[model samples]
Target: MPDLNPQTVAALLPATCRKVFVAYSGGLDSTVLLDLCVGLPAFAGKIVAVYVDHGLQAESAGWGEHCRRQAERLGVDFELLTVDARASNGESPEAAAREARYRALRQLLAVDDVILLAQHREDQMETLLLQLFRGAGVSGLAGMPIASAFGRGQLLRPLLEVAKVDIQRYAQTHGLHWVEDPSNQSSDFDRNYLRNEILPVLKQRWPALDKTVARSAKHCGDAAQMIEAWAEQTLPTVFDPTDGSFNIADLSAITATQLNCLLRYWLRRMGLKPPSQAVLQTLVEQLVCGRCDATAQVCIQGSIIRKYREKLYCIPEQCLQKEVQTNPWIQEQERIILSNGYVLSRSIASAGLSKNLWNNAEVTVEPRRGGEKLKLPGRAGHHFLKKLYQEAGVPPWERDIRPLIYLDGRLAAVAGLWVAEWAWLSEADGCYQLDWRASESM
Candidate 1:
C-alpha cells in the first residue's frame, strides 16, 4: 500500500504555496488528511482547516463543530462556511451539494494558497467508472486531476494515488476519530450505489482493483493532456477570443474528429461545459454543413452556438435576453456600465467624433429602436442603420443590442461601428472614440 503520510503530501504540494487550506469534512478521508498535514513541520503555522457546511444533512452544524475541535486539537486555524445545497430544477441533490460546497470553497481561497482535498485512489476509480458509464470522453475518463487552478489559488489532491485502505490503516495506527456521514450509505446517489453495492462485489474478485483502475486513469490523463496541448496550439488559429467565435473557413482542412476536439476545447475555455457526443455531432452538422443562409443554432447547458457569416459563435444563454432600455451617458464619467453588463468607454483618437463637439454636447446611450440613419464619413448621403449593419456584416442578433450613442437626442455614433459624418473629425487635434465591450455572457 502507498504511504499515507506527511512526506507523501508534502511532495505533491507546489513549492510556491503560501498557505495550505485543508478541506476538513469531519470524515475518514479528510480527518486522516488533516492529521497528516498537522504532522508536517514546514506547514506548522500556515495550515488552516476549512469545514464547509453544505446544509444538506441535519447534523451538518454538529459536523462543523467536530471539524473545528479537530482543527483546534491539531493546532491549526479553523473556519466554518455554510452554503445552501438545495437542488435546482433537473439537478440531482448530490450534484447540487457538490456544486454549492465547491462554490463556497472557491470563494474562500486567497492568491498562492493551496486547498487540499482528500480524494484517494478509490475515489479516482469510482470517478473513472462513473464517467465510463455516462459515456464521457477522455477528459472525464482521466478522472480527477491531482492539481488544478482553483479560484485565486491552487487545488491539490495529495491522496489521489494512495488507496483508501492505506488511509484507514494510518488512521487506525494514529487512533484518529472521524464522523460517519449517513448519506454515504444511501443507494439513491449513483456514486453511493457504485461504492456500496457494485464496487464491493468487483473488489472481491480483484483485490488490487483500485490500483489497477488508477493506473488506467493515469494513462487516460496522459492522453488527455496531449490532446489538450494540441488543442491549445490549434485554437488560436481558428478562434477569435474577443468575440468568442470561431472561423468556419479555417476549419475546412480539419477532420470531423479534430473539429469536435476544437469545439470541446473552445467551450471549456469559455467556462462552459462541452456538449455530449450526440449534441456535438448535431452541432457540427447544422452549424458547419447546413444551408449557408440558414441561421443554425444548438443550445447546450449554459450556452448556445449560433452560425453567422461562416463563423460559429458560442453565446451565453443569459445574453439572449431583451436588451436594456436607453440610458443617459455622462461624458465626464468617460465610462458607463450597461444594466446588461456591457461596457461603453470613451477614449481619445485621431479620427472619430469631434472632441470639441463631444465635450460640449450631452450624450446618451440607447438601444436600437429601428428606423435610425447615419451618414458615412466619406459617403455622399445618409444611410439606414439596418443597411449599414448589413453592409458591415454585423450578426442580426447583435444589431438589436449594439449601443447607439446619441449626442443631445440625435444619433452621433454606433458604438464600435461608425461615427456620423456630422460628428466625424479628420484633421482635428484629438477626437472622442467610443468603444463598446460586450460582456462575457454576450
Candidate 2:
C-alpha cells in the first residue's frame, strides 16, 4: 500500500494552504491523488482539478475529457487546458508533449495558488538516474523537490515517497476508472524504457531498489546545498561589482562542479530557462578556458553570454533599441544610452554628483579595440585601451565588450571600463556618464 494515504497527506497540508489544484491526467497515479485529496480535511472547500491536453497522441483529447468527467463524478471543480506540443533542437517528442502540458498548467494558477502532482518515489528514482546519466551535478541528482516554485505559484509532489503499485491498488480499491497511456509501454520514451525494463531488473537484483535510489538522491541534495553555500562565499571574491552585477571572472575561478551550481543558481535567480549540462560545460570550456582575447559567446534562454576584452557581457537575443548617437568625427563611436533600468546604472550613480549625467552628455560609445590609446588631459603618457583596462583592475575577459568611449577617434571613456581622467565628473564638473541602451523589456 502507498504510505501517502489521504490521511498522511492531510497531516502535511498547512491550515492556510487549503486551496489546491491537482494535475489530473486520467492516469491511475493522478486518479489516486485526486481521491486522496477529496478525503483530506485541508481540501474541504478548496480543491480544483486540471487536465492538460497535450495534442501528442491521437486520443489525448479524449483522455483529457475522461479525466474531466471523472473529476465531475468525484464532485471536484475541473478545468481543461489544451496545448500544442512542439519540440526543436534535438528535443524528444515525449519531452515536448510534457513541456507543453506543464506550460499550460502553469498559466492556470495564480501567484498564491498551489499545484499538486502525482510524482511518486519511482519517478524520483527515474529523475535521479536520468540526471546522473546526463552528467548532472548534485542538484539534479537531488530529485524533484517535494514542493518548489513554478511560474507564479508553487508545485507540490506529495507522492514523492509513495510507490506506483500502491497508486494502482488505491484505484482498484475505490473502483476509480482511469485511462492507461499506451506510450508507457511503447518503449519509445526514456522513462518508459526504465519503467518497463531497467527498473524491474534493478529491483529484482536489490529488493529495495526504489528506497536505495531515493536515499541516494536525498544525499546528493544535501551535499548540493553545502556546495552552494561555499559558492555563495566564493562568488563575491572573483565576481566584480564595478558593473553592479556579477562578472564571469568569478565563474572562471571555479571548478566545473562549482561552475555548474552557480550557473543554475544564477538562472533560477533570474527566472530564466536553464541550459543543459552540455551547454553549460561548453560555456565553461570555450568561453572561460578560451584565449583571453578570443570573442566567445553561448546563448542560453534569451540572453547571450559573451567574453570580449577579458570581460563578459550579457545581452538580449534581440537587437535592443539603444541610444546610439552618430558622430561625424568618429565613424566607430555610437553613443549608446542605457535608458533600460540595468543593474550597471546603479554602479554609475555610486560615483556621486548630479543625476543622469550620461544621458545629458552626447557620449561616444564604440566597441573596444586594440591599439586604441588614451591620452589623459594632464597625464603625459599615452596608455593602450587594453593596458588601461588591466591597470584599472578590470578582468581580462571583460575588456573587449566593455564599450570604450571615443571622442574624435581618441578614447574618452569606457562604457563600463572607466571614465578617462579628463572625462571624470569632479566636484565642479557637471558632465556625467551612463549607458544609452533603451529598454528592450517590453
lDDT scores in order:
0.87, 0.69
Q: What is the lDDT of residue 125 in candidate 2?
A: 93
Q: Candidate 1 on 355-393: residue-level lDDT in tens? A: 888788888888898899899887989899999889988
Cα TM-score of candidate 2? 0.71
**Model 1 TM-score, 2 decimals:** 0.95
Q: Which window of ten consecutive residues has the lowest lDDT sum in model 1?
A: 315-324
Best by lDDT: 1
* Clash totals for all candidate models: 0, 17
Model 2 lDDT per residue over 266-297, tens place = 55444466678788788778766687654467
